[model samples]
Target: MPPSESATRLPPGPDTAVTLGIDPETLETLTYLQREYGDMVGMTKPSGRLTYFINDPAEVRRILVRRHVRYQKGPGFERVKMLLGNGLIVSDGDAWRRSRTMIQPAFKVQNVHRLIGVMIGCSDRRAVAWAAAAERGDTVNITEETNEFALELILISIFGDDYENRFMKEGDNPFAFLSKDSTRDLSVVMKVRALRNLVLEIIEERRSRNEESLDFLSMYMRATDKNGEPFSDEELLDEVMTLVVAGFETSANTLNWVWYVISGHPDIEQSLIDEAGRWVPTVDAVTAENLTEMRYTQQVLEETLRLYPPVWLFTRRSIEEDELEQYDVPPGTDIYLSPYILHRSEHIWPNANDFDPDRFALVEGKPRKDRPYFPFSLGPRRCLGEYFSFLEMKVHLGLLLPRFRMQRVEDDDPGLELAINLRSKRDILLKPSVR
Candidate 1:
């Protein structure tokens, strides 16, 4: 049967004259399109290429799942490739499929649960320094704190004993530049080169030892492709760097926002503290089951992601002709979807601009999957770190919230930076006091 008449036409959308190499601008464009042209919008870029903005959840799912092969990682990926090489996040087709399968086992719930000791150890470091700062009545740079926390945790998780014995031997964290600098320019390139050298030296040392190590590096080193071939040195480096970048920034940003939100709403903050205290009574109580039972804490993190998703905007290319409910997407058409816009779309979320964790509670016969929500994205290529991230976040808040009251230092909101990852435009400052 022929497609519906509406599906034969592209919905009206913004002109390319508007984009400014910024994600928030792209999100603004998407919001305006959804308002002006409904859920499905279409337009022609300045280069005269067709594009579509798909907001329907089901269609979004179908495209990412059953039909993913028809497309490749599209526009805006060049910038990511500059940083990640051809890591899983940027690679497509067989390469992506192969890498994802080989690496999926390492992130299984059991494997992630094994990392809890590291989580506790890292949070204790934060607790010690934070307690000292609270005693001095000092305002804490929670932004930097979360960044360092996530960076250190991911390093320890990835390197195990070597994190303390090797990386710390320099007496300074070598991975500090990633959190301090925002620009992905020449300076960032040089810094990444240095990081690569460090990783390469470690990889070689591990190979020379000929002994088994049970960390992520060991797992990736042993992961072989379908041809029974290990990842090339280049591929291994890209994947490791990808993990370092992805594992830290998103979790850190979520925590930074979580602290801001918790500070503003004392009642909700108290609830989180109570829940954490009740469920996670001690370091011993921080098991996988205990972390999973921190339901309210999970809601808080979800709501925070809705407000500030790390990868706020995603761009893809429609490789084959496709028809949406109200738009005809042609082959080679560029497509832009914004989770930041969809999360705040009032038609789907009432009082969408407000912070409310109650919206996440599971109602009888109601499910959040039905909503237009995709903070970690949707479909097959969705983030591999989604479950791991939430787990780490729950552990962090669960361990810390019970003992400290976090107060926002600034009256004004920290606006969005909207780069590769969503970051606060200003440093988020908060004061921590023992409760």
Candidate 2:
């Protein structure tokens, strides 16, 4: 299909502007624009540059799928670059293509399945702590709990034994700062610099050891470009930090939101418990094959992610002229496509605000899959840790939910914290008691 007759010309309107950041106010801004201008809305930035918010499913699909090569990661990623450098999540062009090819195999289902033991180990730590809290008749701070669980899991999955012997065994988790310090300011920047140095030391030690290992670190160390050259010390640091940041935050936010939702809806919590009991009856049964079989557990996680997708808003900039069903897009026009908004859009999802797990029940030729449900994003740039995250989340909730029940300490809704990820502004406090 080609451009429509009107697609040759830009849509006519006053370029109303809106600033969309990963913050609470941006949500209201996006909603207002959609209501006023429909799916495709034109706006001007403070710099007087024109940007478009495309809420149309087909148009969004075209930009991310068929015409992906004509765009790069835009807007908010500039701040991410300070953290990730030119890593796969931020890099584009042949640099991205090369890195994606070399690192793709490490995320294979079989390779990811190998990390299940690590996931179980991490969740066990949480179980120990939560059980202690339950015994004391104390409230479990699930917000911080999931953050530590996820950060520790990814660190171990990436660094293996080094996570304990090096980072955590020194009386405190060095990476704990990531959770406590939300600001991406100079202080946080310095901390990230220190982390990079630690990673470099580890990389050097691994290189000097001259032995084959199977963790993500070793896999990345062994990855090479088209010329059969490995990543330099600097390039390796970029990717390692990217993995640590990207892998941990998203999963943590999802787990935090899961606890919130589960606390509010006892019926769903009971269903999850039953499902967890049937699938993961014991620690030994919490294996990759078993996680896959927990279809109901998967649905619960899907529902949670649908309600609170971590990467809430995605931005792209066109590098070439393009046309959608009803409008023309000139080269260099910034585009905003949000799964957060679309998932909750009443037009796409009926009763969009409701938390109904039945909506995800698998059906023959289910049409929901065709809709925009991209928590891990879509197309080639989708998160590499997607499968790993789901497996880890399932293991965490499955192993724990059946053993302990959490009651919400407060009746008020835990509102959103719109940072790089959608997090709970306040810590979710739950009274943990044995089931």
The candidate scoring highest on TM-score is: 2
Q: TM-scores, in order shown? A: 0.95, 0.96
Tens digits of per-residue lDDT for model 1, 203-312: 99999998787789999999987789998889999999999998999999989889988889998988898898888988898898888788888888889999888888
Model 2 CA lDDT for position 364: 85
Clashes of each: 0, 0
Please report, in order, the local distance difference test score of every candidate based on alpha carbons. 0.83, 0.85
lDDT of 2 by residue, 2-76 (tens): 112343565433354556676778788888878877888777676655677888888888888889988888888
Task: Record all residue pairs in model 2 with backbone atoms less than 3 Å apart, i.e. clashing.
Answer: none
Candidate 2 is scored at a TM of 0.96
The weakest ten consecutive residues by lDDT in model 1 span: 1-10
| Candidate 1 local lDDT, residue 109 | 85
